[model samples]
Target: MATTTESNPPAKDSKGLSSLNEFNLEKSILRRGLATAAEIDACKAHKAKLASKDESKGLLEIMVEARVLTKSQSMRLLKEAGEANRRVEIPGYQVIEKLGKGSMGVVYKARQTSVDRIVAVKILLDALAQNKEFIKRFDREAKIAAKLSHNNVVNAIDAGDVNGLHYFVMEYVEGGTIKDVLDKNEVFEEKMAIRIVMAVAEALAHAHQRGLIHRDIKPENVILTKDGNVKLADLGLARLTADEKWAMSEAGMAIGTPYYISPEQVRGQVDVDIRADIYSLGATLYHMVTGQVPYGGETAQEVMRKHVDKNTPFVPPDHLNTKLSSGLGVVVETMMAKNRENRYRNPDDLILDLKCLLQGESPMIAGQKPDDLATLAEGDVEDTSRGISEAQLIEVAGYVNGKQSVIVALAAILALSVITNVVVLATR
Candidate 1:
């Protein structure tokens, strides 16, 4: 996930051109520094010979081998060229000002000349356009965002490749993200915080019904309008159930912000579903209610470790802000339970509880205890089965009930044994 922060224009740097292909190598080399005639001729000859033999060797690799261009110099020029190329005018939009810039893309506040509509255009880094896998993921995000139509979600207007630069156009949300608001106002009013998160919860419910999971949910991704309305932004990390077969994230690597990541996400589990989003949303709400995030550490890895470690119990929001009710704290805790089984089973259930709280009624999930959390093994019945047979479900329920009864019976037997031993020793 990209970090959201306001900054001045990016300098002409090589950070954006880390994935340069062979095609741009020559120009990048020339721009870096003047090469002697012998050096240039030698590099060209080497490149030609390599291409003739294999026809697949990258120019940078061949040039570096020929000692014509240093790796650092080649990298520097690629960055400069990429920065200049991306600054060109877009096909339909007239660039106004940069909204924000990240390593992968720059979000520009632009106007569509044909329709004269203001839109936020996010242009991906030129280097990414050369990467086939990155293109597929970018297209996936665009397609998913375009299909979603909700008042509380940012709408994707258009997306396409322009001169090998992938860009997505979205409706311009005039206000800043929830993070921006929190920066100025440390904490929001209790009612206002609930309202904002409630809107986000409803939006998430809609996405969940369509088999979409917004893997990255944080205050940075939640935009707030001038009129106090919320719009969930940044579907770049979203995934579709149908596209799970083609998931791009590598094994052992999680795709989310550390501060708000769910326990399953921290463990890099592949079966992340809507419950992960619930955990993140709960963390976001926790931040909104208090001035601090739920977890904090010196590094991202440490924060993620905290998420996976049940011993590092989350401090309730009420503890941070004395005015917050214990009931509301329980609601957030249930949503952020370490185990998905302890969380709201579905987004609708979460929405119902949030709505209940809005109406001054006790939250439906207020009684969830830490002991209620249950962990499922990778190939367990609950993990693999989408739909359970009626008889199977009854059997499972009976097993669970019987297990509880067995636990109670065992405890009673142990206690009796202790008492019997005490009596025998006293008589002796």
Candidate 2:
């Protein structure tokens, strides 16, 4: 569709244009680092030279004539410029280039006018602009992101609407996402994966401390820089732990990617929290070490079904990747346990084990915790009779010794004490 030639000219503006200007193409190209100003000047001169012969030759046409740009490149630039002009108009930021487009919106690499710095701006898609739910979610995401401040988190800058078109700006990260590298067929080293995971864990810790839970923690949402800085991205699916009213409203809708979503999210549980994020980060770690998702299925529902199924066979990372250490594998398994109670209680604990694995030592926390035995049962597959296997029974027995059960026991003992005191007074 972008391969059209000059014969099919775009709607014309009156001639006598400033030499280097082509609507927004020149500015867009320069802002995106696609071409230099000198290169544009040369193309302008070429356009001027050929103007007498063909008055209709445009800036893009001249660039193609001089071999400065391929037809497809010129067309794509024109298309993006047209799109921006048609709908989006953020007041203080200049949209540079369309970075990407997804179901929710189009993200652009933009320059903040006042600060004169690069930022990424996400504009709600025109198709969804009138949807109240989408607009509310978009606004909420911006507000929530602005509350977080951490080195490993993408910083939110500004958010507003101009004539009904909404845009949210954030720090521009200049590297590929984990999913990008995985798509390129490049595999991450075990230690590198551990370091990256640890960085995200730190980010999650910051968010969790503030009572925010990032429901979607997939590889695509984690950006990795060449300098080894890992930024946890996209708080679109994040929710406040105390937002009971909002939680009830979204009670039954699955809210995250199937490949990395937690079991609680898959079930659309209202009480989903930081532990759900822990499960997703674990799934991401599993993909990082093995170069594959934890489970594969033809459909999203099939994949999500496996996440909530206790009977699903747990395949440890070392089983998939021979180079994986047992320590790192144990950490992944614990993080992705079918039961959130069996997973790491929080990112602080997860980070500790991740650090230990980064060293030559085994996980001093997750692998050695009191709930480690219950985590073991979470890693087992049930028998044909669909009942808990003998091994699972032993692991469940170990669970009575867990902290939650002990707290329950204490409450029960207090209740019994109160009852006994009342009986003695009545007897007297």
Candidate 3:
């Protein structure tokens, strides 16, 4: 589910430590200040206790009694005390709330004061900031992601380390991930599913054109806006074509989530290119349509072996829902092909076939006309050799943005309804 992005060099402050370093330093100073103030308070308490002939407690006992530090925080501080420290500052953005945590870092939802925009800021955990490999990878990925500009891809706004903490800011998507949607509702209708996959395919096409391969593509990494625009997030695991050695090394070590990895990736082959992404996308599409992963096993190793050795299960459109068409099944099968050569040659081709399905044409048929493909209608299903019509394509484009707005509006209504219901019930 992790999204891969290019690493960028850390931004240098006037004093030279990265913004992440500065943030960490500020955090450390605050912690120390709090500790020192507590100690002084404890000393005063001890003096009072001695004068009153009462027993006095140590600093640790006082901190515990006051609930100054949670068990996790205490453990983290103990670990940090064993490491070296450095400090730096980021201008314009202030971390308002934490979004999520990962092995390498924590993601926060921050407000960018300069533009008055909300952004997702990822900061390397203080513990990992000192790891040379993690720092290099973080910088490299941030830089690369900053350079990319694609509608379907989450845009990177800034990257830097403050004090010794590395952080990067990206566009904040308000809607939940595809995984979240699926968790709430197991599967989607074929038409809706195709629309989502097509958007992701467009994103992959853009990234691949930039010579970057998103080694990880999954439902969790794909976010659906309230209006239904699907934006690909998290490019943390992406590898640049230019960094062959490093990219290959990372790929060889099993880079993707086990359930979504391609056969080539599971085999330890570092030469995987766009085709690997195609396979992963196919698996993702399959899950969206059927609510089941193509391959299943108890462990990472077992799942990886299944990816390399086993064939995808029989997943006809009728298997999950009788309303799905065989054409949609064909598209999923083509994507999930174990052999890379048999898969869609590129995302462009995958998108083309999806458009074909939208037009109600048999994607299996040959000699489709580009013009005919471009002239179909929204929600129209027809069998024609030309694929999706241009008009239909335009309608799809309109739907993307329009649907997103609708989703947002619907969410607002739902929230209001919940609040009203709560108030009424409470009053009664």
Candidate 4:
């Protein structure tokens, strides 16, 4: 998935052109850092020699034959080269420079000529243009983005297909993403991290309230403006909560970055809700505050297994960065609970807890309450202890960080009741 972050523009490679084919191929390969000059020259010489022998092999074909470029890689660059020559002829918008590319298409910084405003345009790749499913999903992304109007969300300006080219227009953000900030500053200040997370919490609340779930919420999708405003971008994986057809279409497919993906998402559960977004947000916060991912693995599957496997423990963020407050740690842990039931069910509650933390108070919903503030316990304790009183159960429940604790407490109480009834019946 891609966001509209502008990268250093691709430089003109192979400056002094030999022929159109060689120049275009060299530009494509060199621009992408795919091949060396020796590799390109070898293909060029071979193509020249083949031409002498009446053997008609294109430069790309010669490269494939010589193991210089994979067949798929050469084919893709050839397509990109074809696109490079033809200016994206979207009427009324003047293309400026390439911003970035993703699985979907190439994003370009463009000038909306009529409004004279700078915007980002994503033109779908010609390769996937013929697939109705991709077009529908691409249009769905535009619609989903348009449905949200929060200040912390990248707004959709327009979306349409002209001459079979599907294009999406969005508000151009000048600043970098949270990932960029992490790259520059290893970790964020505690208060700054809270504020940044709070902004995204509010944005997710807006989407969730409208029954939309942003399935992907990694640091790359959390955009930071030059003025320090946080905007959540990349709604390509977002889907309506009520859309079962869409759910089935994506069923059993893990649809998020392995690092920040939720456990249910990693498990490929078809019924993921806003809680999935909350989990990803928690992982993103963990990265921001700790300068490390929640799980480390040589491969993505291993990392995802750590997310899905009950045996793998979820370490609190404070465990990694002892500088973090316990309140923040508890919040991250609860939000990232492998069981969705333990995560914050309502986005508004998450925002509220973050607000409390921002004010130097513990997160009420996800963090342990202060001793003085601990009132009646929420539910009964499950353990059949020898001397613990009912008051102790309630007290323990009040201090529990998440719903799982309360449920465990309740189950212990139920087990004790069943055992007592069985003993009484045996005595009778």
lDDT for each residue of candidate 1 in 108-210, tens digit (9 for 90 to 100): 7788889988898888867787888878878878899998999999999999987677888998998888898787777887778888888998899899888
Error of 4 at 13 (Å): 10
Question: Per-residue lDDT tens digits of candidate 3, residues 324-427?
Answer: 88788777777877757567778888888889999998784222223222333333334345475677557656855565677789999999999999999999
| CA error at residue 182 for candidate 2, angstroms | 0.3
C-alpha lDDT of candidate 3 relative to the true structure? 0.72
Best by lDDT: 2
Top TM-score model: 2
> Scored by CA lDDT, what does every candidate get?
0.76, 0.83, 0.72, 0.82
lDDT of 1: 0.76
TM-score of each: 0.67, 0.74, 0.65, 0.70
In angstroms, the error of model 2 at 18 is 12
Candidate 4 accuracy as lDDT = 0.82
- Name the 10 consecutive residues with the lowest summed lDDT in model 3: 365-374
Q: Give candidate 2 misplaced runs (Cα > 4 Å).
A: 1-81, 85-87, 371-395, 398-428
lDDT of 3 at 200: 90
Off by over 4 Å in 1: 1-86, 247-249, 368-428
**Model 2 clashing residue pairs (backbone):** none
